[model samples]
Target: MNPPTSTWWTWLAVAALGTFHGINPAMGWLFAVALGLYRHSRRVVLLSLIPIALGHALAAGSMLIAGLSLGLVIDHSWLNRICGTLLLSWAAWHALRGHRMRPRVGMQTGFVGLAIWSFAMAASHGAGLMLIPALMPICSALPGAGGAAGAAGPTALIAAIALCVHSAAMLLTTGVISLAVFDRFGVSGLRTKWLNFDLLWTGTLAACGLVQLAL
Candidate 1:
């Protein structure tokens, strides 16, 4: 059977958000480009994405799992409000003190360090929190979603698939941008041609909160 319309939209929203995340330099592509330049190896840039993606999946997956658990006890409407409030608060915090939360990593950092940096960056940015709104309908659609005896297994499987889909989109976007910048533009141009997405990021976060509340 064809999936429901809401399911399609939820998947699309997850992917669209992933693409946005990949576009944001603070997400990891810029760091990947820098690392590639530092090591003077395109291969290094490609390899770095693995850890970055892994760290992001872990960070976002943690939130998904938490939300799934909470969905069992909390009403869907209340959950939405909770996530919306949190998203708004997070946006405000990001606007006010996000810079202080960004983890500093040197070019000489190893794979593990890069993963840790990505995790810290994603967590601070509330990347996973952004997924909750999309995740709600997904989990809610499953059989016995609210504390059902047999629902946990399918819910987890579906959540894993959703996370993979989102992460894949993010990885692909990040790889494209990273390679393009490293191959054609080089990082030097950033000094003169950087597009600051901080405001856009803040705005998007607020928008996501609004969406959650509206839903």
Candidate 2:
């Protein structure tokens, strides 16, 4: 059966944001490509994605948990305001200093190091915070989401499903981009055909904040 229009849109937004994050080089694909090139092995590129996705999932899951916990205490309207303000603030910071803030990991780094870098990158980029808007409705649908009562199980189950869907989308997109770059264009492709995703991401953060506030 088809989902309701609202639910459909929410899922779509989740997937769309994941895709957007995937496109951003800081999210992992570019690093994966670099590692593969440095090691002179396509297999290395494929292997890197696993830890990258795992790290991203960890960051995103933590944010969902935090948002849910806050929802239990804060009024919906105030939560919106707070999240919106955070989004805007993050946007401003990302625009002005995000490039300089990237964690430096050497080419010889191990899987665990790569995973840690991925987690830090995702967190710094506010990748998880972006999901709060989509998450609100799902949590809100529960009767006692504003309380700690019966809402915990259902909210957790739904949040996990949502996080899985989002992470899968991000991993798929990141893998495709990583493989394409590794096999065909190589790192030189970045210099020749780089898209300024930082600017786009900053605008998106601002838009998310405005939308949340407007909601």
Candidate 3:
């Protein structure tokens, strides 16, 4: 189904957000590498991507549910401003603290650990925050947008598609990067890169957040 006419802008925003997420240093391929190191098994390393993708999907799905339940409308510029402000605040905090973030890969390296780590990583970084506001206008503008609880079928479908597309892109991009790093530098090099770039990634997030606020 086509997105509501009035929500085109929202869709574009969400798509852009997805692209941004793909490029974000903090959320990039590094986590995959960390998982590889933790497991010390190439098979497990490859499998870890599954949980990370699922976790991201869950976070985005949760946001979509919240928007639908609240009858959230994104027509208001003020709400965008509020979201922007929040992002900026988060960025400033990271900047001030220099973001001593570390990958907490456990020894167990089981599915449970992978899932928990994936969820924690996504939530901590506000993975789906951009998608929420971006889809709000589209969902609210659809026909029978708020007519009944079940009226959100079309919008929900669109959201599912969007989330899938975004998550797939993330997995592919991250997976490739992880494999490349493992092939070239080995686990030691990957770990060293993660350690060195932690602050840089934090700064990048903070900068993006602030820029969103200003825009």
Candidate 4:
């Protein structure tokens, strides 16, 4: 079934956010290219996409689950306040101390390790919380959308759709960017430019936090 016309923008926004996230090097492509370069193979870089996508999906999915749960227990105003508080707090932590809580993978990282790292990075950055406002409406539209006890059907469905759309967009971008970087400028180029990305990530995280508060 087609989603409501009004909600079309929301889904588009979801996809857009996915694309936006993918563009950020911290999300996956940068690391994947580095790994490939370390091993001297393009195939490894391509293989890296699977775990990257999986970890990102899990991280984003957790937030949707949280949103669904929050709807059942609290009113929207409270939810807004909580989300805002959390986002701002995370931003503050990152600003003052940096992501010390971020997971560290060994030089010889496995798929599971990479996935864990991705989840930690995504969660600490409040990637999922950024989508909460966009999801809350659809999650709360139907009767018991929060599912008094079980997962609300509509909430689950929409969250799944959002996750899929976001993941696909992210994966596509990550693959393309990874390939381009590996083929053209080379992995060293990614390392040279990474410092700038660090600054951008911090600013973006803080900006998103402020946006959550505004919402």
Output the number of the TM-score-best candidate.
Answer: 2
Report per-prediction Cα RMSD to one decimal. 1.9, 2.1, 4.2, 2.6
Model 3 ranges with Cα > 4 A deviation = 4-28, 37-40, 67-75, 97-103, 144-151, 187-215
**lDDT of model 4 at position 85:** 79
Better of 1 and 3 by lDDT: 1
Top lDDT model? 2
TM-scores vs. true structure, each candidate: 0.93, 0.94, 0.71, 0.86
Q: Give the range where candidate 1 is weakest over 10 consecutive residues by summed lDDT.
A: 1-10
Q: How many collisions between residues are there in candidate 3?
A: 0
Poorly placed runs, candidate 1 (over 4 Å): 1-6
lDDT, residue 169, candidate 1: 91
Question: What C-alpha lDDT does candidate 1 achieve relative to the native structure?
Answer: 0.86
The reply for model 2, stretches above 4 Å from the true place, is 1-6
For all candidates in order, the CA lDDT equals: 0.86, 0.87, 0.61, 0.76
Report the C-alpha displacement of residue 98, candidate 4, in angstroms.
2.7
In angstroms, give how far residue 64 of model 2 lies from its true place: 1.7
Better of 2 and 3 by TM-score: 2
lDDT of 3 at 114: 64
